[model samples]
Target: MGTFRDAMSYPLLRVGLIMLILALLISIAGFYRVNKTYSASGTLGEGMHYLGDDKFENEYLYHNRTLVLYSSNANLSLLQGAEMTNYTLVDREITLHPEERPVIYVFNGSVNYTYNATAVDYPYAVYSLFAFVLMLVGVVMAFLGYTQFLRDVKEGKK
Candidate 1:
């Protein structure tokens, strides 16, 4: 296709593709990492997303320099550290046991170490980060190419 062929000519397009793949990988790794660290093994059913709707059916991945998962059960509260620490309940929801009060705890830790992903999919943060970087690169490359093309044209006239 002409569109596809045209896209391949630009280095920005290539970089964009690479960034896309990297973002996906990071998201997967983030989910896996969250699952591993999270004792709440209960299937979130349709993963996690910013908008807790069908449109956002995906795995939940903690983000930020630090994450906090609220829970009272000693095991659930502890992620990296075992010692009992002060935790506050941010939110609550339904679980397997109806009678069981939804537990919550502050799971504070570095996302980098906690998540198995290069960049935890914290709100699709990974994709956004890479996309921004790719955009910056693309701008620079376009400017360079345009300037060079203009220079070449001027030289030919002389």
Candidate 2:
């Protein structure tokens, strides 16, 4: 349509379109990046052992038939050692797959045990949220730009 073509001549509209494209690409990357790993849930106090200070004052260990996990905190010993509290652990492939001693730890669930784990040095959900916000902003900006273009054309300023 002529109206669409005319609006495409607007500079702000072009910038907004570029922003939208970038946001889409970023969101796709985030989606695949998130799917590359998985999460596991379990009770904290079941089969966990207090390692009694290997590198820190409070260190613990958990293991199953397939994987081994070691968690440490300055105050981890304060919690009940064998209480039936729930927890979640992410896949080791996401944390440090290439290293000889890849770090494995438990995370958010029914327990307050905080594990400062990293996925390539950054959190995936936070970055994905930022990309989503960016996409929303881009959409709003594009709408505004199209409306401004229409107004300018109506006022014979285009």
TM-score of each model, in listed order? 0.26, 0.41
Q: Candidate 1 lDDT, tens digit per residue, 21-59? A: 655565555333322122212221111212112222224
What tens digits encode model 2's per-residue C-alpha lDDT throughout 103-132?
222333222222231232222445677778
TM-score of 2: 0.41
Report RMSD (Å) for each prediction in the order shown: 15.2, 13.2
User: Residue 94 error for model 1, in Å?
Assistant: 18
lDDT of 2: 0.46
Indicate which candidate wins on lDDT.
Answer: 2
What TM-score, to 2 decimals, does candidate 1 have? 0.26
Pairs that clash in candidate 2? none
